[model samples]
Target chain A: MEKKQRKQSPQRPAFLKVLQKSGLSFLAMAPLLLGVIGLVGLFQVLVTPKMLTSLFQGNSLLDTLIGTMSGAIAAGNPIVSYLIGGELLEQGISLYAVSAFILSWVTLGFIQLPAEVEVFGGRFTLYRNILSFVFTMLIAVLTTLSLQGLS
Target chain B: MKKQDKPFAFRGKYLLLTVLILYGVIFLVSSQSVQLALLKSGTILVKILPIFGVVILFTSLLNFFIRPKQIAKHLGQDSGTKGWLWALAAGVISHGPMYAWYSLLEDLRSHGMKDELIVVFFASRAIKIPLLPMMIGYFGLTFTILLSFYILLGALLQGLCMQLLQTKKM
Candidate 1:
């Protein structure tokens, strides 16, 4: 097996040698990302600030869950998340909900799940998203409490 | 069933095909959706295309100039807090959609990045260091600092959890 590996290792031209594994993975990423982009485009249409306002009622836990659910469903630039996070805060939403929205908007990626699966594999994607989602809510709660303590 | 296939092929072309089909159905049901989807995707692509190009170019360069062994030496299991800091800084400084970084992260993983660092990278994205001033404007400096710290804390814990769960096997 070692001899066979050695025999197969050196057939590349010098120019192509540098574009081996990383290049191959980069090549694979394109198609996988196409679906992720497609899903994100569809989801973007479904999420709006009006839709978000409907989900929050100032209750910390419930707001956090709704914020997470909405965040997971939406995809955008982090700047957009901050803008939306500010909007959520001004519109009578609790700090917990706003924090959850911003956190998960940046961290979680239901739309990118397939791409993650393609690149990192299904199990890792599932575990990572679940943990991120849970921690997003936790961070949201903690952020609210810390704010309270500070004030 | 001829030994049963793995369904996803690791690259997830199957998932892309499924999404394509779903989009097709949407287009057929309402041609307006085609316009909407196209517009959204076009804008996203326009904004990200440059970054995508740079990232892919860097990946090829990295593959050529650096050996996977060197990558492992810096970012692999025993690289310790330095690896974590590298990941945190990378995640914090990065600006753009998550998908834009997926290819780069995959390339890194192929070259021996630890799963924990990947988790840390994703988690630390919540920090948004450049947006700190704006965040403070909305929520006050104290709230912003605490929130950012909590996010960093969460990233560390999530990375640790992902590591403990053995996500690398996937």
Candidate 2:
């Protein structure tokens, strides 16, 4: 009976130990977390659509490139991406431009590089983002072409 | 054990200082944006913290209850197709900011998750099931479907590319 009781009690300490370690790890990571949040917050202010829309002038192809650059600078939730993508389309931005912006907005993370590097490593973060950035443009152009073809 | 050999990878102080300086410059240019930035920060923290806390707790519980060897066995190198599905599902369902998911991802990486799989998970996040209807409404069904397929294809390509390009340093 005492042996069973002892066994059950050990499980609780095991969980406690895990909790303690996680708490410490969270503390250790707090600085990085705060830094990411701060940077993203600052980006939120500076990247208002009014300020960003003007940068996307020129031909549709040029707009596509500019849109990719804008999206690569920061990221947001999918709903936000969709809403912005929709609004841009309504505002006379070509589907090519808006689509690239949304694509990179969801996929790329130049600003999140520090946090990603902390987790994955510098090479992976840097290279993967570059690939995602390139792919965003590729897919956006392909998407626009395909849609046009269908129409 | 290998994790200890390296110092903490994130130098948050430097990053924090960099952003603060940028904030100051932005403040000089537009005090309104600065105020907007702070307000945005507060709501973001409120919205993100709970989801972030829950993921951390889940990972902690997982770390305690499950051995690393078990994790490596299932989600590691040998996980294969099942692993891909697991990653894809997690990505599609994940919520909040991408950064909120970072710490949990780091935990998975330490437990021997492959780098390619990590890329798959990140890439797959572009697919949000809940938002599909809204997307279809805006872009039309055919365009939406094709785009979603492209996003998934892009994820697979990204993962495979990472696997091929990355050296032993990973």
What TM-score does each of the candidates earn? 0.86, 0.87
How well is each residue in B42-102 modelled by candidate 1, as lDDT tens digits? 7887888888877777777766666777888778977788999899888888877787888
* Clash pairs, model 2 backbone: none
Q: lDDT of candidate 2 vs native? A: 0.78
Worst 10 residues of 2 chain B by lDDT: B1-10
User: How well is each residue in A3-106 modelled by candidate 1, as lDDT tens digits?
Assistant: 99888666433656555544565566667777777777776765666776677778877888988988888887667777788888778888888888888888
Residue ranges of candidate 1 with Cα displaced over 4 Å: A1-24, B1-10, B167-170
User: What tens digits encode model 2's per-residue C-alpha lDDT throughout B104-134?
Assistant: 7888888888888888888888777888898
Q: What TM-score does candidate 2 get on C-alpha atoms?
A: 0.87
Task: Provide per-model DockQ scores.
Answer: 0.50, 0.53
Q: What TM-score is obtained for chain B in each of the predicted models? A: 0.82, 0.87
Chain A TM-score of candidate 1 vs. true chain A? 0.82
Which candidate leads the pack in DockQ?
Answer: 2
After TM-score superposition, the amount by which residue B147's alpha carbon in candidate 2 deviates from its true location, in angstroms, is: 1.2
All models: lDDT? 0.80, 0.78
